[model samples]
Target: MTGYDDKPWLAAYPPGRPPHLRRAFSTALDMFDAAVRSAPDAAAIHYFDRSLRWAEVDRAAEAVASLLIARGFAPGDRLALCLQNNPAFVVGLVAAWKAGGTAVSLSPMSTEADLARSFAAFTPSALLVLDDLYVDRIRPILDTGDTGVAVVVTTSGLDGQTEDDPRIFADVDRRRPADTVDLAALVDAHLPGPGVLAALAQRRVGPSDVAVLAATSGTTGPAKGAQLTHANLAFSAQVYLDWSGLAPGEPVLGLAPVFHVTGLVGGVCLAMIAASPLVLTHRFEPAVIAAAAARRRPVFCAAVITAYIALADSPDVDAADLASLRLRYSGGAPIDPDVADRLEERLGGYIHNIYGQTETTSPSHAVPPGTRAPIDPDSGVLSVGVPVFDTVVRVIDDDGADLPVGEIGELVTTGPQVIPGYWHDPVATADAFIGGALRTGDVGFMDADGWFYVVDRKKDQINAAGYKVWPSEVERLLAGHPDVEEAAVIGIPDEYRGETVKAFVVPRPGSTLDVDAVIAYCRANLTAYKYPREVEMVAALPRTATGKVLRRALR
Candidate 1:
């Protein structure tokens, strides 16, 4: 038996924080409906100079739902959303749920090949895509008639923006396909009326029904769609709202890409649960986000650590711009403590770390508000945080047996937030879900206090001279260097050592990095066998749309 079974982390929970949600909405639609009823006139989304109220958002979603239903979109169908962080994305998500269809979150940055892979996996019946995506990706796929798509709704990414930041919308193509249905026209054609709501009620989805097919980052392998039910999404949202102590009408800055699960739940779902205004800057343009934060006074924000670093480095941003952000958080990737500290110093807020995946809907473990996560003594890695509300996290060996506290193994989790399975991939699902617990391929361990530290991905461990070295540990150490802005490590083949450590270093602006000096820095701090033997200087490391490093690309 291990301390995980006793839930030692609860002892470290913030004052008055409950181990479980007292009450949760049955579905994401119920959560959104409650927000509309509680504050119909309150701003739900802020896009540049424009703001959409809760009622307005609901009406728009209802209109879109009506359009979908009219166009033969049926219950249990898949509605793929291929757009960036815009009002249309939110509207499309709610519309899919309202129409009793699962919303498939597709990244706007996805290439044609990437889109094709997802289409084959999910077989989406409909698509609400950005005009640019429609032109480049969807149209080509539609031409081939290989997809199951029947309904196509297109929107310019600039919808709902009264004032566009040139940095974001400059040189943007607002062109729409002449034959495609316009999302805005749909909203205008069907006003806020009881007819649509009445029609939607008959097709209402239950808690267990899949609400979203959140695509995995595909860092380790081919991306699969994680089937997140309405309950999973709603519960995850409640956990975030309660854990962050977000109050009604307090703005939540949208930093994470809404297409990503972290942004979907933390940015969109959390805002609905808290009845808070979700401030959006279209996409993550540092200058635009900084200005919006300054103007909107967003109280909470959760993004990848890189976004924080970008803001800290942005010349357009000042410390006062981010002063109103009290509950700042970073997720999607691990945070280097030095980077977190530097950002906090520049931005005037403590950056809390959150850990989750597409399968978890959003967060399974998050640092409680007002508390700082402790670093692991051995690995020098910052703790991701304690297991979130009602979640069970165990570090297990290959034999499915629990490892003792402080022993590194795969992290497996089970809770309301965990997904039921991967969409349409029974074999993969079976391999991932054992009994009922999700086997997170993350290599990590839980401590005496129940604090969890993720070393690296299990597949990412490097064996140098028969010694194990986690890239994250070495990357963290390299990132601590004053000259290094970012670093990524990989295992490279070496005849003598079997495999040697290689690091790709991104130098800070105006700072020159010496490869030898960088390797020496890691050598001085880390064990000889664990330090990088080869260092490559790069302007930037390849990353996913959600900011997770693409180590495979380096290899």
Candidate 2:
């Protein structure tokens, strides 16, 4: 069997496409600068009813850098962004990088407890938040002194959307807080002062500087931050753009959430680096996406399997709506072979399967554009394609030795795009990454022809709605219920969600706990995607001789 150490996948690349990146940028900032210099007046972002040119985005980011510097934020400090797929999200991140601060991307769906935990862990000096959506959650966290957040910049979700958009809802005062600054006002403020510009010029970022604190579930439990350097983000964007053959000024759909790695790197960073226009909307509705695709004629889009399924099932989607699409890619979750075929049959284009974790930045493996993924003859599993430019994938045994091709073992990756390590957790960093390679905890194999296939996952994590749900966190929450004596959670096959959490519970002695009660209890304590959707009650949970729960038996 041919080994992958030589990157055999290069042979399978599309005609005329190089197997490696020919052009390089030292950092993502450099890439953005190049795009702005190349096309100052080109359309950079297309929001609901408003469009922002490259000049506008650049000036706004500079103002944000000035604001951060004026607030005493120094290099290496962390700035958290807790918004959705809005222009503010991009501006804030770029500004943070410009001011030499590491930006942290947080999901807008984070609960009060979730925000508090992250704030305590990262100790961000400032936050850019959606005013109407998360004011309450942020207020309490700030009051507790756990997050160390001194500055807060709030923006309305309707900043660029048409006034009649249904997604916009007002829950709190839109007025700026007495202490916090308004993002819109900052952007409209005069250009950077002499002092702020001086500070900005003095702050220099390099390829090795930490650029983002991407959140991910560690090997065993709770979410930990991954320290992705500027080089990691820059490499991911350049590789994706080059491999997809996306031309500058082409339109790409902004369907993925900005908080997710796929959106941050693939959608925003790729669009900026390619000098392409990113068409954006507030939410992911099938009808809306179809309408936008028909109107704007986007050439590329990357989304999860569920989004593709939704588009296929929607009545508004037809041949003309998808005619503009040159390429479509699926990430965040695995798509079944049958489902993938069904999508292609209905959507008129093949959906290439891309694989990566937050720890690997955004994408390490993707099928080359215009190429169909091959299926494993023995297992009938669809291949996840090949490693992108400059990436190395290896299947290894438990002892960290390379396994022969076609043998299923853990998949480890090493490349410029991989994050340096987990934030502030040396133990986790040591356990998850070894000798510059990340143990992906996925059991997969590569064929002699350089095609890769996934068999199963070694980690106890669920991908509900493309969100990582650690079983242990849910199990711990269930065990805290008054009626639950013990609980074991496992991921079950789900047609819509890829995988949903199912709990096997044992009731406390003399206590009555029904399935509905267990579900409701968990729904109250956990987030929507993290809660167990199905529950099973048993007399006692199966345990090993050492009194440990046998999760496999539960499954």
C-alpha RMSD by candidate, in order: 1.6, 9.7
lDDT tens readout by residue for model 2, 1-555: 349777788898988877668656988888888888999899888887778888888889888787777788999998899987788888888889889989998877777888888988888998988885555688877887666777888887678656445533333236566667888888887475677677877887999998889877332457799998998999898887888889888898887777778888888989988898888776676777787788778898887776787788888778678789887888865555767988899999888888888899988899988788998876567888899888889999889889998987889998888888988999989998988889988778999888888765677667897997767567656756777766788999999999999999989889878999999999998889888889999998764221235666677
lDDT of 1 at 272: 93
For candidate 1, the C-alpha RMSD (Å) to the true structure equals 1.6
Model 2: residues >4 Å from true position, as ranges? 167-178, 193-195, 217-220, 460-555
Every candidate's lDDT: 0.88, 0.81
List clashing residue pairs in candidate 2: none
Clashes of 1: 0
- Candidate 1 on 1-555: residue-level lDDT in tens? 787889999998988888879766899999999999999999999999999999999988898888889889989998999988899988999999999999999988988988888898898888999888798777998888799988898998688875656789897878778868898888888765677668899899999999999889989878898999999988989888889888878999999999888889989998999999999887888888888999999998888888888898889999898888889888888776777778888888899999988888889899988899998777778889999889999999989899999999999999988898998899999999987789989999999999998888999999998898889888878877888878899999999999999999999889867899997898889888988889999999899988889988899
Model 2 scores a C-alpha lDDT of 0.81
* Candidate topping lDDT: 1
Off by over 4 Å in 1: 191-195, 510-512
Residue pairs with backbone overlap in model 1: none
State residue 202's C-alpha deviation in candidate 2, in Å.
1.1
